[model samples]
Target chain A: MTTDLKAATTMNLTIDVAKCCGSGQCVMAAPDVFDQDDDGVAFLLDQTPPDTERANVDEAIASCPTGAITVVDG
Target chain B: MDAVPVDTDADTRTDTSSGGQATTADDGAAACPHLRKYSLTPPESRPLDEPDYFGELRQECPASTVTLGESGSSWLFTAFEDVKTILADTRFSSSPLTPGFPLEGAPGSDAPVAVTTMIRSDPPVHTRLRRMVAKDFMPKAVEGYRDFVCATIDARIDSLATLPQPIDLIESFALAVPSDVISKILGVPVEDEAMFQELTERMTTLSLTREEQYQVIGEFAAFCDRLISLKESEPADDLLTRLTHEQLLTGELTREQLAGFVIMLVSAGHDTTAGMFGLSVLTLLQHPDQLELLRSGARSWDSAVEELVRIHTVVRMGPRRAATEDIEVGGTLVRKGEGVIASILAANHDESQFGPSRFADFSIPEEKPKHLGFGFGPHQCVGQNLARLELGYGLPRLFERYPDLRLVDDDITRLRFREGRAFFGIRELRVHL
Candidate 1:
């Protein structure tokens, strides 16, 4: 399922590119909110995923090898 | 540049091309003139100052050929995008049975039936076989073994603490952890670990003669057959038993297929993980600042492990694939029937993808780049979650137990590597706690 872009914008998702080891676990765990750059480093497709996408995004954060992705509550 | 002879001594050099397709060039030069004749396996031979010789090639000749002694030559792809594309694209076949496919050491016949495991298959068959056991290797599934893995590491460390100073980390801990974990997963009795480890070691040794390799593989297959029979009557909670009861008995898999599965799992699960553990430790010790960061909690152990795997890639050359049809990779035309070796080592160190200090820098960057350490696409390592868990649990506990841990030999240059092996790792790491 897709996340609501407007709702996601409120979530304050940030990805530290340098910390991203590019394991792609984030993308795998939460494809709607996370995507990888050409080099395989992760990027936020949607900074603030909707409440519906929270669980998977949480999983993405937990699963990230480098802990590069984070979600701050608005 | 002219073709450089890798080995001057005839007796010592390994001829990797037993079933290699004959080259059209009489003088053993690659068809592509710009392609240099180089052996990608043993990175230790390269000059110490220029550790990243392959990086030079990735820049100058992204797709080049390297002659493999008598076995002819194969195309080597060095760029990150090219390597990933080749691995993901189905146009490149993974089957070594195909004629002209690059044979690194010997003919596939010398290897076990499992040499034809799902890793070497393509499309529907690979998808079917891999799907059967894919769930067991998922992050969640591997996470189930976390407690067990951590406990095992602690127990091993506890045992090592009793040992005298200058302990070989590889023998005492690194090798033992993964060996035990894989054994437990396969339901092999702990007492029989030495036997299985021996077989696995022999099977992975690139220096062994074809006959020797075949013998070891035969023993391994027979061992798996016996294990399968045991699981047949009395099933356990382990993977082998699950495969036997759930997949094999249901006619979804054949006896040989079960054997292949067991063999592949046992070998893949331990060797690469063991190599990573030893290499990571060495890499960290060489860079005390990074080690201090890890120990001080400045850098998360999870990130450190990923960075370690990325920087100290064990698998130099991934499985060779033959181009099914003429395909363009990184602007180079790889003609049909040409063999391609995706240099996982080179791609991981590609500066453009990972920034300038990708190879030399030990510090973990805030932006972690995707690496090919576990490979990519459909044939990506199934046991990656398990391997990562082992590293995540093992590395920190190792350093925490002995914060003063350092190499006994200050000269890192003297360190002995498992030369000519498919996986890169220290033969012995004498560490003082």
Candidate 2:
């Protein structure tokens, strides 16, 4: 089942930069688990990424229009 | 003239599916007397069909409270998770100078001073004027201007093969490739692109008047103060010479907010992708098997430009807010200084969010959802990554440089749409290759 939910989950990630709305949509859906800074906000170039970057960190937490990227499943 | 007109008859007196909620106002201060009002009509269909009265107010009462006049009622919302919780809820306030901002022709309180931009400010000044042009429209700074937006969509498809045969397509190639890729990313002057596309087409022509739209918004703020004093004495590597040498020489911007960010980025970068490239080229010439599945490469001009920006939501009466407190959303409530809206053409056609036969189905389904069509929170859409790199290379390079184009009247009410603009487009398509 999708490699048993990526070997029983780990993912991690978190963002919030005051609910970042620089609308990079998490660097256009997970450019290596999100990047954007020169004031476009969003950061974490891999807060915990790999499990083959969990389907682009869950499509950058489902295309973030300010639900400001999250993903716990630790 | 439609920034909420919707009546399309159906209320038969507001029962609104009982479960769909909204009937609040036990003196939550007047005006919800069983909702459904919305006045000021006009968009009576055919710019790539949608007006089935917002799919009958998104199956009635998606978050009700209507009225919108004698300066009163507002709420609206229309499903898709209550228009994504009134556009990612910052307790709703995108200021049309707040104090009950509904903004359908808004201008009172002895109206005068205007240039608000940062899409009518909210967060700490719309988060310091959208973090000074948010890393120049980010998706890796618009994928480093995709080869100057594919050489301005191949020089507007090689000036539509030297014009002649029934050509219009919004004056040769969907308004000349976003007015030559937003006048070369706001450096402007290619000998002032014919007076910046005639003052951004009389500032988005809704039949100008309000004294000729304030004398073409004072000649487009004196042509963005003469292109910010010729980019402060010749500097150029554009985006107004890096915001005229970084935020207008460190006063962190203000030459009337860099001429209201070059008249709000050349009238929202060439009239919303020149009305989404004339309504995504009249929806790929009314879906020729979805333009032969993006001409046989079997789908993906980035999911057919995000399903033609979710069936031409075209800013159809959405983004307006006020609440500032007393929220509630889909189950209604609303209150504290009221006026809400959100709609985005009824939450990108919410048949409970893209089901009930996928809201005006244009078929590109490999799973869809995720469309408020360039709108949602902290003012979503800072040139939506240069409008998806100009509709991902201007709709498959204008159907791969005219595969026998066609459309010189397949009679969709003889084309011309765009009336009193709040972005829904096609005011001249014609075509014929």
Best by lDDT: 1
lDDT by residue (B1-433, candidate 2, tens digit) is: 3223232221222211111122364544554444655632434443355555556666754666766433345667667887887888877887666667764333211123243667777787788888888888888888888998898788878778887888788867777788788888877877787787777666655444345656677777788888899888998887888888888888887787778678878877877888888877776787688789778868777877877787676766567787877777655677666677777766776765564323235677656457888887888888887887888887777787788888877766555666655566767778787
Q: Write the residue-wise lDDT of candidate 1 on B261-357 in tens digits.
A: 8888888889899988987888788788878777677878877787788876776645578878877886677767877788777788777787543
How much is the lDDT of residue B16 in candidate 2? 15
TM-score of 2: 0.33
TM-score of each: 0.81, 0.33
If you score just chain A, what TM-score does every candidate get?
0.84, 0.32
Residue B254 of model 2, lDDT score? 74
Poorly placed runs, candidate 1 (over 4 Å) = A1-28, A31-74, B1-31, B41-52, B106-112, B356-360
For each candidate, the DockQ is: 0.07, 0.27
DockQ, prediction 2: 0.27
i-RMS of candidate 1: 10.6
